[model samples]
Target: MLRVLSLLLVVQLCVAQQLEWPKQYTAKGQIILPYGDIVEPFTAYVDMSGKGRSRIDYYGGSAIVLNLGDEGQYGAMFKIVYETTQDFANVMTCFAVPGASGAPVTPQGVLPDISMYKYAADYMYNDVMSEIYISNNAEEEKNNNYTLLVRKDNKNPILFRFVGLDRLFGSHYDEYVIEYSDFETTVDATVFDYAKKFTCKGFPGPGLTLAMTENPMFEFVGAGEYEEKHRSYKVDSDFEEFKGHHSRQYDDEGEEAKRKTHFRHNHRYIHSMNRRDLPYKLRVNHLTDLADGEISRMRGYRHTPDSPRDTLYKPSISDVPEYYNWRLRGAVTPVKDQGICGSCWSFGTVGTLEGSQFIKNGMKNLKAFSEQSLMDCSWGYGNNGCDGGESERAYSWIMENGCIPTEESYGGGRYLMQDGFCNVNKSECGAKISMYMNTLPGNVTSLVMAIAERGPISVAIDASHKSFSFYSHGVYYEPACGNGADDLDHQVLAVGYGTLTPGDPDSEYWYIKNSWSTHWGNDGYVLMSRKNNNCGVATDASFAILN
Candidate 1:
């Protein structure tokens, strides 16, 4: 009984020792692993966790000890586990050494070089060691078989290399695998050095063999108090040599200049008024008279406000009209040019009225409306010639005083005086007028849906002169673009929405037809953001239902 108890005590002591935590140590200058060697060692600090017991963690990964020594050096070993049968296929290992102050040294060679070809031979580099290797696992693979050794002097800096596992194999899709094990050999310095080496065995299949040899001799370096040295190396090679295959010159200055130019041009045309002979107030009053009249015609309907400003409403994909098969042929027309005129309001109002007419009359022909008639004739609602106006007001004017053809009542012709009589062909302008009324104060989605279901609807937006230019993206609000909220003067037609791709829940983007020429974005049809503030679209109508 006494002998048995003693033996049990001995066994318990051995187990306890094996499970004990390794001592912490400061890293010395460098650690090295020679070529063709399987194992190397270095020193490192260990931190354990838990209430009573803990585990080692380095760079956020759990660490285990493979070897321990009091002399302050450590050893690590790596082996290839798998290789590919395909030619030119290989695998390789790489090491990431910590720079001074514990930052990682940038990996040296072009990542993913040829050594990554075969499966078994590729597993040679241990990133923790800042070294890599390529080697063959099979004798039949001897043609490409090779081995790499790495070592670091006590004061020397680390280096990197690519060891050919035989000759280069030219192919893609080759495979390789490797495994690495690390251990701490000594304790003293805060600095740790890691090293790795690789050996290759030939191709996979029968006749595969590996040579058995004694482990290579390794030296143990002692730890001592030394001043920390922080040094960095600069590449002597030309930067052009390192340029990626896809690299290109980016002209940031040119891009900025173009953007500025676009903004400037749009700003001037939209806001600035250049009066040739007529007074500024006269021009503005004429445009305002037309705009107010148009808006008054649509005042009978209930105007609803958008509830949630940010939420976007999209029409169901199935309900959207097909592009080629759409039946509202006359509703969609080419964008018109409002040349050097503050008459955007008139153009927008008339264009929308035309679409509405088509929807109400079931007519397939689109009749061009006379903007000059409204600019010159409308007294209370719109501004004068070449001056700004409101679109909704223009519609009200048209409803009250019916519009004639441009031939019968021509515009003051490009900075010229407004002729009271029609100068163009009056027969072409006699299209029947139509109107639609809104039942609720609808948001952008509801307005568009009403158009899609009922017919084209006339809507007002803040079209201050500043906002006349083309905008690629982003929301337009007052104060930011100098367009006041009350500047809701422009009129437009909401024709349809662009197609939505799968996964886009709110794909119902508004397709607004602008009075600006087709040279504008997407052929004068701006894609308005459907997410908020009704995308600046406000709907009001006079005719609730056409008789």
Candidate 2:
């Protein structure tokens, strides 16, 4: 109540004015996601070479390079991925935003970042601001000198609450809060080292692919040989915390030692990349210790490649809103965790059904459908319980096998997180579907239209990239993700679609709701780039029409 009243009081005495910023500078701070979730501490260098080229170095061993060129236009985050267990740890992964330049560059594409120290003197023309408060510290709520400003657009009054009004580029807006500190006007030329950004395997530049060559923590004489190449080093305590975050435990001490070595190499890879400006950002997460084979085991989508395309509905992409999300309309459900199971397809199917019901009516009639029933009972439809399955197949099972039971009806009041016996009453109807249909493969136009008219659509994509497994949020795009039928191995629900920058045609993205629990991603939701079919996201898209 006090926060609201304070905002109201400020508005009453609000003096609308334009905000100013620095043309180029250097600063250090942290990026915060919504609801006060912080990424890691960062040091940013902006406007080097007088070409708007800049970089934000995250403390946890990753950096973002922006405005370098065509490849660096949308910016990219440096990440580490192991192709195979034998592969040495390096920055083999570079998550990038490769697209045509748009009218407004979103935070995802903004270089040096607004938190990096204002890169430009001019601010957003549409932004109208009112003074909120002034503080000695940018982070302090009630202090002495630095000012706080509330910048808003004509539509959303609560668009952005920027701290550090004295320092034009403290932080910005709605979904994220980029905090700034330790300001310095002096620019460092060494900050924009080519090896840090362009050297990434996914970045389109010289020897980008050669980054696969690993600086192994130990020496490898043969394919599986392991020996010390460098002096013995003690494992960092923070690495143990990283392991604990993922609940990783090794069976044998040798394997444990090997993984620790791998973890150290991965850490060194990120730390070295942060020394200079990079086009992308990278960070350690649960999947950092696992190799490609181990990560692939977690992907569960099994749509057959070379199968005939099943085009069911092709709605015209006309008169549609540029941005639409089912969650805004109360159609999409809360993000759920799938635990350690590979039944992601079932969650996608049930979510789509639940959404369709909500869209047809409203949230008053919505119910949490059972994913366990599909895991246990839908095996005859080619769904391997708790293993892997296809979303279209689950839809087929529902079409012929009657209605799906609610989560409560299936168990008591919780999910049966693993494969279980068939306890579902086929005759009972908690959520009934009329039919399930697929849109044209790789067609973003039809997919967007169908989602806008229909409800959440069940979509699949190639989620094998190590970056994808530990995506911390932002517009997730990896040049390493393959775009083919054989590549789509994870099923998720597309609840909505929107652009980070309004009126920017090239900045649109799909709101993919994952079943990997709220602990991962943007609280279990991935804002994947749209239009390019980057990872075969729209290849096997399907949705349910509630009866």
Candidate 3:
């Protein structure tokens, strides 16, 4: 009994380190997703003025602003995404506009409930940091357990940790850790008031109605809807079209056999939410235009062989690390939206250059290379701009041109929908490529080594399937997804590689960076199964040598 009392005293002392929480304060911290292996740093501000408001800014050029007016009354929960080219932010709010009576938008529970946060003191410490476990069994909150790291001086927690096993994918444990920092009380009054001038749009994510404002944290706009309308809305005419297509397919197959065929071909894609979003018309368009099915369509090559490249270096006695992510190393760039254009090739090409530049000149000096420049300039080199292009040809042109301009300088940095004339102005150039090569097909080890040594590898995949469009998370592996080099339709960048469980063969996967924007997949990226040549990721990998 005496030892237990002494241990409690020691634990209390450990948690005595107080947080400096002023009446109005600001805190900065990084939110980490262990399963996705994504780390996003954010800064949040609180204003205790008239109604009480807070704003949180993500490092990925996005933000969330909330108005805590009265008890249970949320004035506005707004998400503002910064548009670098437009020089302004795009706003999506959860509060209804004044006079929107028929469309009474109550909080559909998008944001996490902080009402329980005050209960932190009631919990016992699990660690010396004053870490305590709390139940998120609240009616609105997603069913999960939370471990919070708290400070003595303030009621606010410094970190919120969530851990669970993936039920949809193979049974793999996932962890999400959000750590706060730079806690201060000072805040700007203007932050509390919503910015009405910004581009206001619908909240993103499934199940939320367009008529009602959605919780931006959990809600996301579908890619198909974005492609058709360029923004999120309550109305989903595109979704209706997809339903019609599915109905037609259902009718085409006899009812008895329909269920069995659907079950067999779609079980692999069952994990994807994208299939629900992809319409038949859009799928056809993606297949015809964006798919990179032309190995024969590719231009000049150093060696005629289409097989694997000869290994120059071999692994020694040292064991390869189980996990590696280029983003954590500051080698990769922030996610960028490809917009309506099928410019995945250009984005992938530029991503390789950006990663290589970080390796050579250090991350601080690295800048976003121009995909617009690649689209406008690399004409005769085999790319048809937004229509589609060859990664090898883009690399070859960069080598000859000597330098490529930064996205900001090249034609004002905005992604124009159509192809423009070659605008290779050396005076405005920001980066130069020395050389590049196509990785040997079917060589996972060599591809892994190349990404580890150099940086992101540009590659192609079979994105014609509906599952590819609405990918939310998890290692994507569809048996229906073709494995041939010609089956590769969409171009993406392989940024890193890791395993769900260290040294577990089934857990191996590659981290791919997509150009479809942050709302698309797990914040503009996807995990493809490693080693099995899943979805043709290892089929056609390419890397750039940067200056």
The alpha-carbon lDDT assigned to residue 504 of candidate 1 equals: 46
For each of the candidates, the C-alpha root-mean-square deviation to the true structure, in angstroms, is 26.0, 23.2, 20.0
Please give the ranking of all candidate structures by lDDT, highest first, separated by commas.
2, 3, 1
lDDT of 3 at 38: 38
Give the per-residue lDDT digits (tens) of candidate 1, residues 1-547. 0011011111111111111222332222211222111112322343211111111122122111111122122212212221222242223322211123232111111012232322111112233232223333432322333222222212111222222232223221111111113334344233222212434333221110100000011101101111012110001011122222213233674443333323222222221121001011111111121222232332221112331121122333335342221124667556666644556556655665666555666666565557667666554643444545554455455555554343223443331323244343333443433333542343644555555664555555654432234343222222332122443545566665543333443433556676555645455566554444343564332121222
Worst 10 residues of 2 by lDDT: 217-226
Using lDDT as the yardstick, the better of models 1 and 2 is: 2
| Per-residue lDDT of model 2, residues 143-175, tens digit only | 213223333332111122223222222322112
Worst 10 residues of 1 by lDDT: 208-217
Relative to the true structure, candidate 1 reaches a TM of 0.37
**In model 3, what is the error at residue 132, expressed in angstroms?**
64
- Residue-level lDDT tens digits of model 3 in 369-393: 8888888888767777877776777
Error of 1 at 460 (Å): 2.2
Give me the runs in candidate 3 sitting further than 4 Å from their true place.
Answer: 1-319
